[model samples]
Target chain A: MRSDRQNRTPMGLKIAAAAGLAFLHLPLLLIFVYAFTTEDKSYQFPPPGLTLKWFAVTWNRPDVWDALTLSVKVASISTVVALVLGTLCAAAISQTRFFGREAISLLVILPIALPGIITGISLRSAFNLAEIPFSFWTIVLGHATFCVVVVYNNAVARFRRMSGSLIEASMDLGADGFQTFRHVILPNIGTALLAGGMLAFALSFDEVIVTTFTAGQQATLPIWMLEELVRPRQRPVTNVVAMVVVLVTFLPILAAYYLTRDGDQISGQGK
Target chain B: MPHAVTFQQVSRHFGAVRAVDAVDLEIAPGEFFAMLGPSGSGKTTCLRLIAGFEQPTSGHIEIFGETAEGVPPYRRHVNTVFQDYALFPHLNVADNVAYGLMIKGVGRAERAREAEAALEMVKLPGYGGRKPGQLSGGQRQRVALARALVNKPKVLLLDEPLGALDLKLREQMQEELKALQRALGITFVFVTHDQGEALSMADRVAVFNEGRIMQTGTPHEIYRRPQTRFVADFVGSSNVLSPDLTARLGGPRQWASLRPEDIRLDTDGHHRGRVIAASFLGSATRITLEIDGETLSVLLPSGSAVPEPGEEVAFSWSPGDLHVMGDEA
Candidate 1:
């Protein structure tokens, strides 16, 4: 009876699952389809025609290049910051017992749990009070607030799953604190940090809500794409840029998924 | 000569629970010693104290006559084979074995040679390149053993290292470990809850219960003369005769104990019983008898004519077999 329950899914549940997946991905599919549509200014039930012209148009645009470069730079910097801070936070949270440790962990994850607009507005206000003018660094900082949460989530889960005996054994086998960290702890946590960093890079790459608040004049690719949507530029070109952003963001997330999927089978410390 | 390891009035308390309390122990150099106990019995905690992984709450621990207080595990001249092996999964067999040599700043080439020698010592000569995940339970145990031994420390600590292996493999490893300890001529302090393992391998055994040492003696002495009820029951099975029986048959002692093997059935001897139950073991038949309304177990050799349940029989034991116990019994 238990096995039968697992094997047979109700039709309603199957339909709901499919509907949920379509709700998420169908819009992204439409963006991909419209990227090659010949219609430059409007949408149609089916593309009246198709062309390779948008690819050329997007390639030649210097604004696109600048925005893409800026987004890449911000994501890269934010991911680096997230990796360092996130792993340290995870190590501290999991490996130690102190008062308010749970509270600190909750605080670490609060930024991501809050709506992006709230984080963006708060960062903007903090930057304003400090008299700090918005720049590339401000955009990077805005994205890093959430990026750290992503990295920390991945890292702390892995940290909790890891066996503490590995560290103790290293010390017992004659490794000092530094040696144990270097040889034992680091290797154990390395792949989790990598996956977390890649995920952070993806999250920062396509982020628009926070960028709009922190980025004053400089436009990241997503911000520039938002501008193109408002103005009467080549509509297909906007879709083409959207395609680039999707691929850029999607690949890392896919890689991160695979990294974490295989991560469950850690280097086996037990028989 | 100074003892290899000594603990004087050691106590370790966590919050309100005494994980290890007022324990005093001494191990001679090159001794194959076993700390035997059930889980949460403080055997592992005592081993940890000697390795400097844990500190005494209010007493002294010495290793090779040097105070172990406040000393780090890495600084202490000791190494451990953790119960789960704890071989670094990222490293292959050789690299795991060479971890200590690398930490000591030995040159890479020299470390490699020693690691190879260590692997050979553990009888896994060609397995240097295989990851720990590729090895079986017994092989991983050997790797962990070699990893600790490579440092040539004065003392080696094993925390239930064979707990994961199957019965046959556990027995094999027990023999191999005993032989290895003899070959190395280094003090080995091993923790295990298996009474048979302690009896078959250790030169001396310390029985722990409830964060306290119950007794320490050679396996023969411990089994033949358990001082406390815990030792009698934990180290090996024993039957504690009732107070009435002790007063009648225990001569002058306040309490009396007898091993099951010591109790014999003669069918013609003085004491009489009706066999209440019988189990056919491979080498011996376990016979449970009701004698004078109290239960007594006897082991009769297999292939002999065993009395059926409800059959009346006679049993007897020599005066020397009635081992006495303290009030703690």
Candidate 2:
């Protein structure tokens, strides 16, 4: 009976899926092709020879290297901060029945759902009112605000899937409160935490709008790419850096998907 | 010794619903106690209160005579085997068993040694390297037992611990758990909705209804001398007759309950009834008979004379076998 449906998918669906796959991968293929182009000035197709000159140029540029290092540092710090705060919030909201809990949860997820420009503008205004200087730390703070929502969603979903009886069992087994969290609760949510951290790192690494607002003079890789795009003195080098960004960010996302795929079904079942 | 556990009129409320209401119980050291009830009868809630996962809305709980107020579950000298087993999927069997010991700061070597010993006690000595996902249902249950017992708790709480197993495995584990309790000499508080599980394993059983304890006594006392209609009906299969029908046999305002095995079905007896249905079980034959508009079920040994449906049969039971309850509801 099941096999009958398996053999009967319409031709339209197959064509649509092929189109969707091409749509997603074509831009990535273009970026890779342009990164190796010999013509260093334009984005024209079919005229440029292939060369590895942009790769060597990208490796030597001090500004690009500094921007890459800054992006990594900001992503690491923001991810850590988001993980601790998001985990605590998820644990608090998951285990207890308190007043306005649903409202608080909605508020927690609001930052990630809102437009990034709006978050950037709001953070900029807030910093102006507080009269605080903008630096690398401000960029980390800006990224963390939205990054926390991703971590919170992942962690809370994992917590909800977890059997409450496990925590109760740990406590009953002569484990202190800390011990129960360390031994039982933490182990159960470890996969979710890793997935959330990876996702948050990827998000922070590529965040451009908020980084532009918070970064006064220092540029992250994303901000540097934006600057290079507007003033195209080194177009091929920019393509090379863009390809590198895509690779670095894509690997973590794939890892996060694999880590969280099994438990993702839990939320669907919960509904 | 003082009672291993005590609940002093414990009551817990979630909003307007009382999950547990004014429950008072005392469990003795080294005794196998069972709380038997239907779903939502507060048996599991009461177990959670004792486990410190929940705090009472009123009253108090004590472990070994010390007030359990503000005492975290890890600090209390009690362990629980959860209904779902709750074995850590990330940890192998040995690490799971050693979890409680590690929490108490036991050295790695000693904790591993004790975990192995606990696994041996549960008869799963070589299963230490397997994840819970790799183990069968029965093996998982045994690992859960080993993990809890490795801590050497003063009292062990099992919340429907065998609920996930098949019937045959459930019966096997029940006997093994009872024997383990006796061998360890630790107090055990087992919760289950299955009356048979409670009756066969517990030294004493507390039958719960609604949110209160209907009765608590030795299994024989509960079965042979039920104090309420609920107790008799919940504990075992009973033919409960109203006061009007039992009035001719005894007094008014008295309901009678008779076990199926106690009622004899023969060709020559005082009371006569027509068989409505007959089911042939492997070891016994069950005949449902209607007497004076009331239905009575009789269980006779296999290979006994099988009465056809609609055939008249004589049914009677010894007067001493009848359990009578006063109008308390």
Candidate 3:
């Protein structure tokens, strides 16, 4: 009976699925093609020629190196901050009952739900009010605001899905609170945290608008790419950087997807 | 020796609802005790209290002569096999059984050796390398048992441990658990809603209802002489005779209980009733009869003449079979 249903997928649905895949992935393919293009001036179809010169050019640019380093630093720090804060917040909200718990959960996820421009403006004003200098820390702080939400969303879901009996069993088996967390709770939520951290890193890596308001004199990779687009200093170099960004960000998101895809099958669940 | 667990007027309340109300209980050391009740009858709550997962709202609890009210579950000398067999999914069976030893900083080699031996005792030897998810429900149950027993807790709390298995497997585990408890001489406090399981397994059984114990006694005593109407009905679904019916049955004018197996269908009996339903239960046929607007259930042994529903039948029990019960609601 299941095989009969599998064999009868409508042609229109198949076409629609193919179109959706093409629409999402074709631009990424274009970015890869242009990264190798000899045309450094503008977008050209089937470029007059493809060359490896752009790769060397991108590699030699010290400005590109600086921006790449700053972006990596901001993303790495923001992801770490998000991982700690998000997991803690998720554990608190999912495992306990208190007044305003629902409201607190909503507020924790509010930064990501709001527009990036709104978060950026509010953060900029807050930083100004506090008279804090906009250095590398400002960008890290800004990225962490939304990065935390991404992580919390992933973690809270996993925490809620986890059976509370596991914790009880741990304690009953002679584990203290910390020991139970280390042996039982940590193992159950470990993959979820890893996936959330990966997504947070990928989100912070390509963040543009929040970084724009928070960054005073810093040019993160995205801000650098935006500047190069407006002022025209080696277009293919920008495309090469974009290709690298895609690859770098794509790997983690892919990893995160794989990590959480079979998460429902955690052992001893529904038993 | 001190009692394995003692609750002196222990009560746990959640806002307006009383989950475990003013209940006193005593479980002896090395005794197989069962707390049997319907859901929400405080059996599981009392078990949790002994495990130190919950603190009483009032009154004191002691375990082995030690005050247990403020103590944490980790410090308590008891372990539980949860209904779902809460095994750690990430670890293999061996590591799971070794989790407590590891927490206590046992050497890895000894932990492995003991976990293997524990598995062997549970009849799951060499099943250690597999994850809990790979095993069937029965295998997971045994691993949970091994995991808890490996700790050698002074008191072992099993909360509906066999509730998740099939009927045949439940019976098998019940025997295995009883045998294991006997061999180890550990106090086994089992919580179950199954009367048969409690009856067949435990040395003493406490029947609970509405957050209070209706009665506590040996299975034979509880079955043969249930003191309250609730106990009589809950334990075996015996016919609870009203005061008027009790008076008519040659007993005092009080509530009484008559076991279904005690009544026999006799052609010359004085009592006559119309059969309402007849169910064939393998070795016996249970016939429900309406005698003077009062319902009476009678069990007939196999090969006896089976009466059709709506037919008039005569049934009678020995004068001693109708046991008078207390007037408590």
Clashes of each: 0, 1, 0
Estimate, for each residue in B1-329, the C-alpha lDDT of model 2 and write its tens digit: 67988888989888898888898899888999999999999998888788887888999888898999677777778888988899887789999899888877899999989999999999998888888889999999999999999888888999999999999999899999999999999999999999999989999999998889989999999898888888888888777768876775454657877788898876577778899999988899998988778888889888788889999988778878877777663
Model 1: per-residue lDDT, tens digit, A1-271?
A: 3787799999999999999999999998999889999888777759999899999999999999999999999999999999889888988999889999999999998888888899999999999999999999999999999888888888898888778788888988778888888888888878888778888888899889999999999999988988898876588889989988888877877777777786443110110
Q: lDDT score of model 2?
A: 0.86
Superposed Cα deviation of residue B247, candidate 1 (Å): 1.1
RMSD of 1: 4.5
In candidate 2, how many Å is residue A149 off? 2.7
**Could you give candidate 3's per-residue lDDT for residues B1-329 as a string of tens digits?**
89998999999997888999999899999999999999999999999999988899998999999999999998888989999998998899999999888888899999999999999999999999999999999999999999998999999999999999999999998899999999999999999999999999999999999999988999999999999998999998999999988888778889999999999899988788899999999999999999788889999999999999999988788878888885653
Per-residue lDDT of model 2, residues A1-271, tens digit only: 5788799989999999999999989988998899988886678897458899889999999999999999999999999999999999999899988999999998988778777788889999999999989988999999998888888888898898888877776777666677788878888888888888888898898889888888899999988898898775679899999998998888988888888898462121111
Of 1 and 2, the candidate ranking higher by TM-score: 2
TM-score, prediction 2: 0.89
lDDT of 2 at B171: 89
Clashing pairs in 2: A175-B74
TM for every model, in the order presented, reads 0.88, 0.89, 0.93
Q: Write the per-residue lDDT of candidate 1 for residues B1-329, one digit (tens) a residue.
A: 89999999999998899999999999999999999999999999999998888888899988989999999998999999998888888999999999999998999999999999989998999899999999998999999999999999999999998899999998888989989999999999999999999999999999999999999999999999988877887776787776666665535546667888887788677788799999988999999988778888888887778999999998888878988785547
